[model samples]
Target: MVNLLLENGDLVVIEQSDFQQLLDVLAERTYQVVGPTIRDSAIIYDEMTSYTKLPIGWTDVQGKGTYRLKRREDDALFGYTVGPHSWKKYLHPPVSYLWRTNTTADGFQVTTAIEEPPKLAFIGVRACELQAIAAQDQVFLQGRFVDADYKARRENIFVVAVNCVQAGGTCFCASLKTGPKATSGFDLALTEVLTGTNHYFLVEIGSSAGADVMQAVTHQPASPAQIEAAEALVEATTQQMGRTLEPLDLKELLYNSYEHPQWDELGERCLGCGSCTMVCPTCFCTTTHDTIDVTGETTAHSKKWDSCFTMTFSYIHGGNVRTPLRSRYRQWLMHKFATWLDQFGRSGCVGCGRCITWCPAYIDITEEIRAIQESTNKQEEKIGGKL
Candidate 1:
């Protein structure tokens, strides 16, 4: 354990073994430690009682509509990119029961559901994910009508963020300015450094709670060389980006692109399967359902995840608002990149690229945005020609 208080922040150089002890410390604090684990051949976050539960030597290869897990020659707990699941599933559950009701003759009794937000320690959270969580905080907490359940769940969770030492083929956090290194919104952050035969983690404390946790873990001040190694690791990951999303005026671009022919093209390619929204780390669309019992005495009112890709999402009394595939596709893309700004004061996307990786039809948001830009440029050229 080597700990140092640098000018930038508090830094600690801990061996691989001590990293496991950090998990134990969190467990002792009664935090249900959830982190990356190899399950069904993919790195998924779940309850991890021991460091062994982590995908120690596993990484992932991700591309448009493609994902595969591969083994690294060395042990690295969080070598992979964002998986099919996100922290959203835990805080804002995929399926949640809001309340139930029981009818008596012509009257009804309503029962409110109780929420038990767990004290959770989220390990191996990437920088892009941290940004996504921040974006969602605006949705669930800062919104006019706060989601009580999500707020409770979010308030109790402790985040241990991980700096990306490697980026997936579909990742574009560099362009989003959200990754390679975690700047804030974490209790602690870690950068994995594999130095020849030795592998270690550079731990950084971000909050007072994190400083408290450090008391339980074995750690020592990081040397200058180790600090340099950590910086280099982040730098290398930044340089190895597999994709890039240009930070254009996406709001204006998408707003003007409503009539672009590309929407029709995307409609043809899109399967309306809702894979993008399902895998997105920040998408928060949901629908409520009420089920009546066979006896007509009891009913269950539930809330579940919804997607703009589905026709049912825009359905109203008269008809489905977005009947055409192009309209549905346009609604999703426009809302994600355009109207979200008006609603949330920020774009909905955090540029994790999970939507691209998990989409059954290789639909890439970056590619689509670029297409919109090209179309805009072409339209400008035509107008200039007439002038």
Candidate 2:
């Protein structure tokens, strides 16, 4: 172990062996280290005990409504892009027990669910995913009512972010300025460099915790040339994106094109299965349910992840506000691009492209946005001609 004190903004290089030791060090600190692993023919985030469990030499091919795993030419862990699972599953959980109520001799008594939050150290987090985590923080932390569960889980997290060296077929983070390289929101960021007969990682310390962890691992200061090489790889990744979203007047476009025909066309292709929302890292909507006993003396309330695509999501006293499938689709898309900025200060999407990859009906949001732009342009052209 190197006995040097590490600090934020420091760049270091760790060989493959030291990289594995980094995992051991984090685990020794009593953190539940979660990372990307091959499971059921797909890369998913799960409890990773050893570095060998990583998806080494395996990459994923993704497209609208399709995903597959392929073997890489060399053994390079963290070679793949974002998969169907996101970090939100751990932070916000699929379901949470809120509280329980029981009738006593005098009156009703309530017991709020309280438990210790797990100390988690996430590995292989991408840049766009970091932005997604920040977006959720805005929703659950900075909002009027802070989410106790989200806060408890988020406060103790140790993030190990990965800089993307290759772009996925569905990725467009470069266009959104959310990724290809992680800039913040992590304890440590890694850029993998695998050359002939050489394999190593260029690590960036973003926080003191990351620096402390590095003290236990064997590493050396990265040379300027090594840093440049890592940067060149990230630049190449930015250019390799299979999709791109031009962020010009997007909020205004969605807000103004409320009745655009492109939405109806999208409705015909969208399956409303909620797969996109489930895979999206930044989507945070949820619904609560209560269970009552036959005697009506006890009740248990719980919350589960929900989506605006569901018909029941917009249900109210009289009926569902978004009855039509087109309306539901419009609501979801508009919220991400338009209303979300009004609610929060930023766009909801981080451009990870999981939604495009997981959509069973092959709906591509970037293409949809382009179509809306074209339609708006044509409509304006006709109006200008009349004038």
Candidate 3:
């Protein structure tokens, strides 16, 4: 809690010194501030106490089989891109206890689980990652079998999204129409604008809670030049992206490429390491397990995150369904771009490009899609010749 004072005026144009007030305001409301911090040589989401914890003036270079943090020329709080961690780490945790039971001498009764969710305030969230959280909401909260833990956590979220000022080497959110700008599903959205001798955020109010938080900080009305500068920076980021995924007709294109040889090609490169699923914000598969004490006096049931890349993920009584690497890869790709539409009415991938950057084998999904499309075109050409 850094000491900073604001005068009696409209709190709209906040300065860097006043940023700490925003966290203090959330803390006063009993909302724990969870945000990005540089650890393990990567920017990760963790419990943040002050503005000093933010990775200021740091951006990252991300590509297939590559990632490195680099210092920026100017001081900007939200200049960096996303890392291996996503908001789902808090909203939908990797592990949680379902319920526990203790045996009684006379009789036994099942003890159900009831855990209250935390009041969370997420800082420095990106637009594509926000879209990823919305997609996860459809999986956990909107479905018939609502995940109680996820629902509890989702209900109490307060998001502070940041628009991208610089695109990473593997970024493609523009192609997926998901990012470079914060559009919706955020409480407060900010675009960091840094001009010569001027650095400020063009803040946009998205929710009542956001407005309440704004009251705690000191701000002034933004000039038209500032707003235009913000827009220009976002457009620059969009144009500087390192990859692209064609969104038009993507569903049908993937759906019809079931037998594409690219699946076999990528299967050879894919390590089945589950890195993509672990980094992906939208991958929400889980498996539950029960643990009993040695004396059998108590039992505990818990659920944790799982991945389709595992052979046992599709296991049945007989054996694994997707045993082969090719089949497993096909299932993952097709489900993300094809069948996910039929199930969720939207593409599962938000084009965050974590799968492309963090992969040990450099297995790029965009390249796979391109190969499939080329193969499809060749087959169509052959058919035309036959006709």
Measured with C-alpha atoms, the lDDT of residue 356 in candidate 2 is: 94
Q: Which predicted model would earn the best TM-score? A: 2
Could you tell me how far off, in angstroms, the CA of residue 292 lies in candidate 1 after the best superposition?
3.5
- Residue-level lDDT of model 1, residues 1-387, one tens digit each, is 434433335888778877888989999999999998888988888998898998888889999989999888887777788899999989888998889999877899899874688899999899988888999899889968888888889989888999998888988888878887899989889998886777788989888788888767888788999999899889999988889887678788777778988988998999999988888888889999998999989999999999988888988999999999999988888877899899988778877889999999888989999878887888899999999
CA lDDT of every candidate: 0.86, 0.92, 0.85
How many Å off is the CA of 161 in candidate 2? 0.3
Clashes of 3: 2
Give candidate 2's TM-score: 0.97
Stretches of candidate 3 exceeding 4 Å from the true structure? 1-11, 385-387
Cα lDDT for residue 275, candidate 2: 91
* Candidate 3 structure, TM-score to reference: 0.95
On the 0 to 100 scale, the lDDT of residue 41 in model 1 is: 88
385: Cα error in model 2, Å: 4.9
| Model 2 C-alpha lDDT per residue in residues 29-108, reported as the tens digit of each score | 99989999989999999998899999999999999989999999999998999888999999999888889999999999
